[model samples]
Target chain A: MLKYFEQLGHKLIEWITIAREFIRLFFETVFWLIVGPFKDKPVNFKSLFFQMVFMGVNSIIIVFFVTFFTGVVLAMQAAPQLDKMGAVIYVSSLVSISICRELGPVLTALVIAGRIGAAITAEIGSMKVNEQIEALETMAISPVRYLVAPKFLALVIMLPCLTIIGDASGIFGGYVVGTTSLKINAGLYLQTTWKFLSRKDIYTGLSKSVVFAMIIALVGAYQGLKTKGGAVGVGRATTISVVTSFILIIIADCILTGIYFFSDM
Target chain B: MPEKEIAISIQNLTKILGGRKVLDNVSFDIYRGEIFVIMGGSGHGKSTLLRNMTGALIPDSGKILFNGQDLLKLSVAERERVQRRFGMSFQSSALLDFLNVEENVSLPLVEHTKLSPKVIDIISKMKLSLVGLQGFEKYYPSELSGGMRKRAGLARAIAMDPEVVFYDEPTAGLDPVVCAVVDQLILDLTRKLKLTSIVVTHNMESVFRIADRIAMVFKGKVEQIGTREEIRNSKNPIVQQFIKGELEGPIQIT
Candidate 1:
């Protein structure tokens, strides 16, 4: 019993230290993003552009497909129940509102957390192991400023954009199911989606996506920068980064959803 | 000889890593424009000491004075100002594999200078040429052989025309011919640039070939510090055993 408590205490301290480091990295990254340009030490725009392309553009197809299928499944599941109430057309509103308020942002964030998050961890972890990061320090370069900030900035900008695309594609999927499978008119389906999806729902989902982006980028970068050993270490960090990002994204989505639901905003 | 000018002074440097004293009470002065080699067997803190001197690793307790300025006491901005005059070559070469040779060499210049892209390009080319790597500027690091990668790393290290260059096991995984070539490049660059070179290596041949002075560290402590001739004729058993590459010695391999 004593040994168990000791182990638990050690684990708690370790987590606290890790949390502190993670917060520090986030602030340092933000500092570089905000202060670097005035100091004539701007985060490299070229690198930032590349990260945007990789994280946002390359991810579009995957996000679209994932959310589209989800919308289809959602519509198919909702139509049968709503038909008993003589309101099968409500399936359009159900799919669009859910996609805008919940599914689109959550699914898009999870996918990016899998893709970009893993890549960030692997890239930074390998750099850490290979002494490239130390080489940067030797040259008076902050890896956080040069490396992490651009990634953070790019993800912050791109995730919301991807969520928007995911939302549209998901609504299109719901339209397809409602029009063809359920024999609802296409115009009525579109009208129902537009009517149900309010500005609050759209903005709330975008806001959730923004928070998820920070979580993914920070967790990935933190795991990466602290990576030890070598190739195995990078692999381990990548896995942990993705897993942590996934868990955090879901938890954050739950909390944000609760806040939006109860706060009456 | 005129009194040697001290470039960097390490005073009672100590570092602890993973509950072990990786460097303990390490003190030395590297004179200006000299090749000071820190040599010891594998896992003996030679690299750790080099990292400390290069400002890559912070010592737990000690002062590293570069040109009479204590590096540890400086603010980040001030430390960075001091650090810009320093460069390091890694054992693994540590070239940004994503970048081509030209871009890799130009990294420090791009980060630290207000020079235009064209000027940075020319300067990076000049540095690569100095290391005999001019023609390979377009090639990525993965496309280069081990020897070429090391040379490119050397080019990048000297790209800023730094006041001090720290090399960690420059010839660790190289063939003899390549090792000689690297040693010759180190000598040439140090002589031509008048830069203080601090090399950490256990290779006896490379050490003797290039060292103006040598420091042998053992178990996180300095065992001996002397000129190559003085080290060759030293009375220390650990020094003799290490230099001679002998199995029978105070250094027991477990």
Candidate 2:
């Protein structure tokens, strides 16, 4: 029993250490960004813009197409249940609320985490292993300011943009299902979507997106920066970065959503 | 014997990594305008010592005095001011893979100075020429040969006209001709630029060719340090075994 308690205590300490380090990294990245323009920034913004494009514009088609398909699935599932209650007309409201409030930001964040998070971790981890980070330091450069800050800023901007696109595509998907398949009045569908979905839903989704963006970039960069060993270590960091970002995005979504849910109640 | 001015004075430096004493009570002084080589067997803390000297790794205890001022006690901005006097070339070259050669060389110049692009370009070209890599300006690091990559790394290191340049295993993974070329470059840079060179390597031939003085690290301590001729004539059997590469002696081949 003593051994069991000791092991549990050790595990708890381990997690706390990880969390503490992550929070420190988060603030350092934020501090660099807040003072970025005033500092002697040798940041490669051209590369950052390209990465932002990769994170935002490149993911557009796939994100929209995937969310469009999901909207169709949501409508299909909802039509039967609402129809049995003689309320098939509410499907447009149901789909719009679900996509804007829940699916849009959450799904976009998950996909971006899987795609770009792995890349950030691998790139930074490779640099860390190669002594490039130390080289930068010896050059009087802050790796956080030079590397992580640009990534954080770019992703924070891009994820919200991608989330908005996901929102539009999903709503359009619902439109198609409700009008052509369900034979609901097109005008009525539009009215219901607009009526049920307020600016708050859209704003909150984008806010969630911004929060998710910070999580993914910071988590990925943190894992990458802490990487030791060589090739195998870099590969492991990439995997952990993706997994951690995914889990954190979900947890953040739930906590934010719960706060809003309760306040609205 | 004429006394030389100390460029860097290291005092009883000790560093522990993962509970292992990689650097233990090591002390030495590298004179100005001299190529000081730290040589040892693998896993023997030679590179660790170099890292400590370059301020990349802070020792658990001890002082690194650059021209008599303690490097470890300075504020962040002040330390960076002190650090700007250093340039470190890694074993792998560690060039930013995304950047072209000229861009990589121009990095420090652009970061630390307000010089115009035309001037930065000219200086970068000059440094590259010094390293014998003049025409390869547009090529990325990947397009260069292993030796060319090392040259470019050296070019970048000296970009800021730093007082001290640290080279970690400069001739590793290169042909003998290329090794000789790198050695010649180190000698030329030390003479022409008057920059202090602290090199860490196990390549004994390179050491003898380039070192003005040598420090042999054994078991995390500076077991022996002397001029090349003195080290050659020393009666230390372990040092002799290392320089001779004999499997018959004290060092256990792991």
Question: TM-score: which candidate is best?
Answer: 1
Candidate 1 lDDT tens digits, B13-112: 9999999999989898999999999999888999889888877789999999999999999998898898888888999999998889999999999988
| Model 2 lDDT tens row, B6-62 | 999999999999999998998999999999999998889999888887888889999
Best by DockQ: 1
Q: Which numbered prediction scores highest in lDDT against the true structure?
A: 1
What does candidate 2's lDDT look like per residue over A70-167, in tens digits?
88999999999999999998999899999999999999899899888988899999999988898888888888988898888889999999999999
lDDT of each: 0.94, 0.92
Off by over 4 Å in 2: A42-44
Q: Where is model 1 more than 4 Å wrong at Cα? A: none
Error of 1 at A197 (Å): 1.5
Docking class for model 2 is high
| Local accuracy of candidate 1 as per-residue lDDT tens digits, A1-265 | 9999999999999999999999999899999999999999897889999999999999999999999999999999999999999999999999999999999999999999999999999999999999998888888889999899999999999999999999999998988899998999988888888887789999999999999999999999999999999999999999999999999999999999999987775
Where does candidate 2 clash, by residue pair?
none
